[model samples]
Target chain A: MKHSIHMHSLFEKLNLEDIQVEDNSTLYGQANIERIRKLTLDKVRKDRKEMSFSFKRQLCKVALVACAVLCIGGATVFAAANEGVRETISSLLGISQEKILKVGESIKNKDYKLTVLELACDSYTGIATISVEALSPKAQETFFKDNIVHKLRISPVGYGLREEAPDEYRRYFSFSFKVSKELNLYPEEGLTFSMEGISKKITIPITQTVELTELDIDIPASEGYPMSYQKLYYSDLGFTLLGSLENEDVNSENCLITIEFMDGSISKFYHYYRALEQVKSDNRISVAKTQASIGRSERSVKNDTAPSDEDTIIDFDTEWFSGGSNSINSGKVISIFSFSKEMDWSTVKSIMVNGTTVRLH
Target chain B: MEDYIIIKRLKQNKEKALEYLIERYSSYVVSIAARIGGRLLSIQDVEEIASDVFYAIWKNRGNLIETGSLKPYIAQIARNMTKTRLCHKREEEPLDEDMLVFSSEGVDELIIHKEQLQFLRDTISLLNYPDKDILLSYYFWNYKLTEIAERFDLPLSTIKSKLYRGRSELVKRFEEGGYYYEA
Candidate 1:
């Protein structure tokens, strides 16, 4: 092709500004005044008809609300208590007051609110358990003795995993009272609780924020090999447990980055969910490391000097096929710390263990 | 509410239907009419021509379809009205024939092409914040390599590399987000 000739001809083909602007003047209105009322807007909207999936899907909104209400007030709570010993305690005792339960008396009543607020639950082998950090109304002190949180039952709702429990659905619930009226309330204290007959128990402990250090990871031949990859350096590994009510893409499509905290909680940061409509989603991004690992910070990995020693490593193993197109060589490991694209030296978090996968909570 | 519906109820009347129709698509009709008018005539003259086009559509609504399409139907009305307005205003003098070549490129085809472009615009608004900004600034805004470098505060080469890689990233994300279609 004649490079200059082609360029000149292309330039003559169309005015780039006119092509860019097209007839999209309505989007950026002219310097004029106009007022549209509700009826006028609705009429115009109906005239310019278009199909919307979100609105169609929203037809099921009423059904979902009804399900939510029924699941909250039913026998689901008892299911947790009978399912396992750990769940039995967590259902009734509340984390901080786990061990402080008497036969019939409730020890830390004020702390119950805190425990409920911070409730975290996990289930294994059809049994569910919950624990939360609780503080007594009084300062540091131990006043309660070994007591039991009786009548433990958990009501398990078919929350996200509706397909998992087709045979039977169950939830959990628990309630406990001191054996005699002589037992009075202590202002501040700590304790653990378990179900009446089940071994499932929950104990709330003092919560504290701890610094994260590098956990070196060696890619076994088991996953794949890297062709050519770059390294990224990050500063601080700001870690937090994935809570239910937070800004997250836990259920986004093809999000391979899952962060597991030391406290048995899990969260995923799928970057593909952040792209625009014209972009294709790359499935090669592996989120299979289902175990608890450090989540890379989006802000810390800017293109500058490395921030600090607290940074975490995200080892992206981009193994290209031998016949793959472009410079993407098959079998390449490009490790990035945080969101930086430049290659840098680093490793994974220390909290992650080998041979065992840390699943997200 | 019923008055709005009453227009639809009286779709059989030629003049009444045309009046309601003009009131209905006035904004879109005016804007598109303005675009064509601005290029061919003065702004004030175009505005007058656009209003006249609306009046013509108002007088001619009985001939229009009830719902299948609105744009193509109105575009035809605008074109005819514009030709009439131009002939009366420019009867004594004529413009260069070459300028008319630009106008000859079927405005109707352009109108149809605009529907697809509007669909693309709607799709962009549905994207997440970061992805939407990056794609719009790079493509629609058309900042050059050095300009982007200064704006994003990065090395020129880094900006180039990022633009190359970011385009690919966006392509992948767009497909994954179910926006892009395989050829």
Candidate 2:
């Protein structure tokens, strides 16, 4: 063991591990870009590439849309609302249609169009659904085909999470986020949507709130693996989970949190449904074959066999043990200032699902 | 955009230039920050360090060297900032000896090593995801074999056996790349 492998090369080779730009490193890139987008361009207000003109102008623009709030009967909600916008809002904000107050409005400039189609509100959840469509058909073609985006600084008027559309939808990009309670109040004023080299504001508003039922989920120690754990927090629209494995030996082998809602509608939450949808997509990274197939898992290494169709490569990151839960809690849980009341742990009935101990009060 | 163009824009006090650089080198910045911070800094802390690195570079744009590339400069700043954060968290003076890995190496040797490093990197990408991740994290990130085993929920023997295969794969790549290791 006197001569060992030089650790330096490996260190440097893995240098960009966190970035992995050669692959889909969007998880990190999105965060960094979002942060940089907040940095003001300090240019003319007309071009929004991350510049804010007057706050008053932003407000007045949204206010100009007379029917910022659309009145739809409970049964006619789907018929009255734009399907694309409704889906975008529900998917983006992790809200249900019932929670929306106003939707389907637009503002545009010469380059891109911005529309706020759905606004869901709770006392604190002000999730706005906004869509930006490029004016040029050629630009839209490239966007849809290549999945490349202009270095536009698109910021929600509030503090919220952003979920961008897929490549095909990039030309008519849609996003939703939970904004600050203050920002929610001014939803009529759309966000400052800026392009890589241009800028503009889109006037629209989506506001309505749903009080999701919260329950205390209690788990017995036996439910978790020696070092693996799963916590599923549910709301009306969807649930969230914080799955972690304390045991480092597992290459993320076992993480299960199956949900059973009172309604057979597991599709109620956008995030959960989306994950299932992506896996359903023909290009999904399918589950890997168990190395223990022959009771000799080491064969995977020795034979150096090309991975079988049964053994798909898992591009996994152990650090992000959290998944399956929808983006936001049941419904409009956006807004920094909105705080929902907690569930009383004592009132829930304890139950079991697949040997996982759970308290469902 | 070219490095020179970005530098020129930064010099002109255009904030978007900084944004462009951030988008381009974000992965590089994150890797450096996480490496230097190790397990000491939280994600928030590491993020702040990365932000500080970019801002520091932008702040001192006038002093940048006009040759080569800005990558090494950015890496140096990122590592230094991370070290500062680590020192603050540990409440100790910077340990220069621990910071230094090798006292010196021949210039030619260094050059060859960097070249070979490229070979290692390409091979890393070529390897399947699981094997690549196992080798890189175990060797580069300083994660213990047991730690990895626990994290991935694999048995200890399985990890060691896989690691042995990973090393063999490494050796195979070295031979293929026209280099020999003194094993």
Candidate 3:
């Protein structure tokens, strides 16, 4: 009664030529294809038009907001100048324009000038926007053309630039660094931003930190994976789950977090490793072993363990849109769940993890 | 119609190219989706999945390689979509028994490794004519036993026996290769 999960995985990896089959066109008539074609073409056209319209509308909105901020004639004027930075901070951090900390810090060389425009940080995550402007035309031609900005590094947590930027602010780039308390990577003092070929470095201090509501509650272990909860820190942006697992085979990916709001709304976050490709390529044997161990653990749980009548096991039907980062060090696992949209943490009634619920209120 | 020509037309944003693609691969997509979905999904569900697969193809036309055959890409999409649909359906209802096949007697014996998967692939390739074809049709394409029987013009019992024998051969090969051990 062994599961065919591995078999399915094996089959998927097979060469296309090996599994080639004759076209059974009789199963689906010509009428079916025609209908599919029409529907697909209509969708493509609609998507294209909508994308165009959306881009134009967003540009207009951002432009208006930028102009409005400039007209106000205050600290916001700096943010208005770097609209790309301001927009990214607003979107990613789920914060208002006023809450965005304006860091008018700059470090320059003969070739280029790098300016730190804005930054937002909490207990776990930090996002900063930096503008790399070429000082000379030659620098612009050689450096910008080659896209050498990726050579820039922010120590401890790596930085990723925002791919899509308005044409007007093509030089503006946003770098985000996330630090987890459980991992002991929290930059209590500041972050060091440096670039290759440049001797000078800029130290952007963590001046302002967003207030996070902390909840300390002990949740009983689920039948499948034996885990103990320690703390839950949540804000308007997202939430973090700090727990310890007795079984190392119980991957954080299987730990589904569902937040039930006071208003009867629910938000689910599925924990997935961001470096999954790296794990598969670099540690294939380890991954296979982990999978096998997980299978064994699941089998034992099913055969030996029994849940009490009060215990309810929730099976999530919907595909989770929000992503969570999981890191396990010495049996202690930290799962940071990021929300797709801004949430009112006060309105949350209870948080459930793998069917075990802990009331917050 | 050739896959390259169809890919070229798709890249050019020609709607008729999509029609050609749908006409050529609709049956193939439907077959994959139907086989994967099995009794869990209705005819309409399978049809919807087929449409979605085509739509995905059209959407990713720019990324499609003009030289390579589109069958693999289409097959992958069909499998993915059908599996995703099944997962969502499983959330709404009780777990599908076929999907949640547990190991007997709580023994943690069978472990599939990357090397073993490669060995399985090699073994599958070396299989004799109709056996190889039947195995691919049954496992890779996820064709039903009855469907394989009909396609091969063989009896259902013969098809089943062939599949069982093929699997046993795979196990034996794996054991000899030191990739698998019987419990």
Candidate 4:
């Protein structure tokens, strides 16, 4: 079936009021507004830093894994979809988020056959649930039994199918890669989906961005509430964020987001990362909650501990924590929760812990 | 003005075209970045991705300009850049773990993502600004519902209910064939 999206393009989907086009300085109250020249210069500065002979280069191929307990549909589930595609993706339409395609539609190529059972298409990622069967018994035995599958790589480099894990049966496989390379959300013609040597491609006629309710929150401010979206819209009372970890390793995935769209300026952003698996309720010396914003701390890097006002870090530690291969029991979850960003302290009307909401106003 | 004219200006003068595009679509870029891998990236990283996306589009002005629309191109570029950024992050600073679990591919659980993005897109387009922005950021950019509710100073209960209502409304619209732009 052809998909017919309502917009001429993805840009048409954005609300006009959200478009802030005044000069960065006037809008953001920044002392200096950067011109394209300075932005270009920053690019030059980066290249120079990279080429400097004294700078040591490191390609840290850390095997970062996000072991999520509590099935809160963890944030990293889709981003770090290194698990069986089945485990991470569910039906967008069904309550269980079931698959869109089925295995009944299988296609074959010479000595082997391929079937695409599921297709997960977002603006950036297109994941296919595939089933492969060898025509010859010998080939099937070698490919499945000995796990001599690495030799047969998927094609076309970046757009090619990656050798993820198979389903319960040895025949099923899943692959996900970038599809927005040609994501003309509103092309003169609609978009299409197809894969070579895998399945027939079809033009997706429609694409819609899901609508959540508009928040009618206005943090009453005397200092004329900061213009930043977060500060203006949500930052009222100070609160903490807690998370459960799949592993206890020095995961560099932890990040802090701070920038002023009004001024088009960036401030000092501190990057901190740590993964905790062993230090849960059993060892964290906590009673009920595995993690709460009040008691969360950094379990890695002790040397240079500098806290900034942009965000808060309450009761933090310096020891690095990591996890083991065995998935921690869901019952006894080993969490690596840390403090996320803090609001304006005064603007918060409510505090959210996990899914539970508390009125703080 | 047509996309080509704007692009022509870009080709002749880099700064002016960039200024225009940036003024027009910076929020759009951030929205998409958040949808794709915004949670993993800092705002600076998102900015870097936006800058690079514009630069790439400018460099390939010939192909895109003729298309007469920069919206889809921008969206596509934003997505590609985010994907690239995520891939790079996975390679360089992916969450550090002692053990790596290989992804499992399944056959029985195979089903289309049910074209959910399409219906959601149309429903969102009908929303006013902040509402549309909130949903886009939450779903496409992976922002937490609670975070979004907090951002808007709304209760988490309110946000979840609205999302539920909006989603239900969208499915109803689809069932009724109400929001089809192509027809």
Best prediction by DockQ: 3
lDDT of 2 by residue, A1-361 (tens): 1123455334444454431322222223334544533332221112321221212233222222211232111000000001111134443333345655555555555545555555554333334445566666755655444422233344442221233423343333332223333223233454344444345444444333555433333232222221122333333322333222343332222222222234431211110011222334544222211000001111111111222232223321111111111111222211111111111223333323223435342
DockQ of each: 0.02, 0.06, 0.12, 0.02
| Candidate 2 structure lDDT | 0.39
What lDDT score belongs to each candidate, Candidate 1 first? 0.28, 0.39, 0.53, 0.35
Ranking, TM-score, top scorer first: 3, 2, 4, 1
Candidate closest to the true structure, highest TM-score: 3
lDDT of 4 by residue, B1-183 (tens): 566767754543233455677666766776676555423455566667777776676555435545667888888778778766654211122112211122122223223123334544567657654555444444334456666676566887776666555545565656554333221
Q: What is the lDDT of residue A265 in candidate 1?
A: 36
What DockQ does candidate 1 have relative to the true complex?
0.02
Off by over 4 Å in 3: A1-88, A91-94, A142-149, A158-161, A167-169, A180-182, A220-227, A252-254, A262-265, A271-324, B1-183
The CAPRI quality class of candidate 2 comes to: incorrect
DockQ of 3: 0.12
Off by over 4 Å in 1: A1-28, A31-361, B1-7, B10-20, B87-183
The reply for model 2, stretches above 4 Å from the true place, is A1-98, A101-110, A121-128, A136-195, A199-208, A220-233, A242-254, A261-361, B1-183
Residue A185 of model 3: what lDDT? 50
- Candidate 1 positional error at A176, Å: 84
**Worst 10-residue lDDT window, candidate 1 chain A:** A319-328
Candidate 2 TM-score, C-alpha based: 0.27
Error of 4 at B169 (Å): 0.7
The candidate that achieves the highest lDDT relative to the unseen native structure: 3
Q: Write the per-residue lDDT of candidate 3 for residues A256-351, one digit (tens) a residue.
A: 455567879675433212122343354211100000000011111222122333222323211112223445566675555443334556676766
